[model samples]
Target: MTTVAAELWDGPASEPVLTTVRVPVPCVARPGTTLWHLDGPCRCFVGGPPPEFAPSTARG
Candidate 1:
């Protein structure tokens, strides 16, 4: 488990507030030469803004 600070809005009229959320870290496994699997797909949550609302970042 990992805790991260995030901004969340309760309602449309409410201002966004900073809060701490517990996110489960994903576990990955690769078996042999051709098998790859994610062990916790159900425990995953999207941790960032949607792609349409994401801020631009510089990539090099």
Candidate 2:
């Protein structure tokens, strides 16, 4: 398993929570977490390819 950062989004009525997930490729999170591969626009309902794994660039 690898460590990757994720921005968990439930729905329009909720906010996004940035966190880390340790899992193999092609994985899935809970149910409503909007998953997006850091490598690209690849979408995952639960989990998928782990991103490059990095902190938010906006926080320079």
Highest lDDT: give the candidate number.
2
* TM-scores, one per candidate: 0.20, 0.18
- TM match of model 1 to true structure: 0.20
Please give the lDDT score at residue 37 for candidate 1: 18
Q: Which stretches of candidate 1 lie over 4 Å from their true place?
A: 1-5, 11-16, 26-60
Question: Which runs of model 2 end up more than 4 angstroms from their true locations?
Answer: 1-38, 55-60
Error of 2 at 23 (Å): 23
**Best model number under TM-score:** 1
After the best TM-score superposition of candidate 1, give how far the Cα of residue 4 lies from its true spot, in angstroms: 6.6
Model 2's lDDT to the true fold? 0.44
Q: Which TM-score value belongs to model 2?
A: 0.18
| Predictions in order: lDDT | 0.32, 0.44
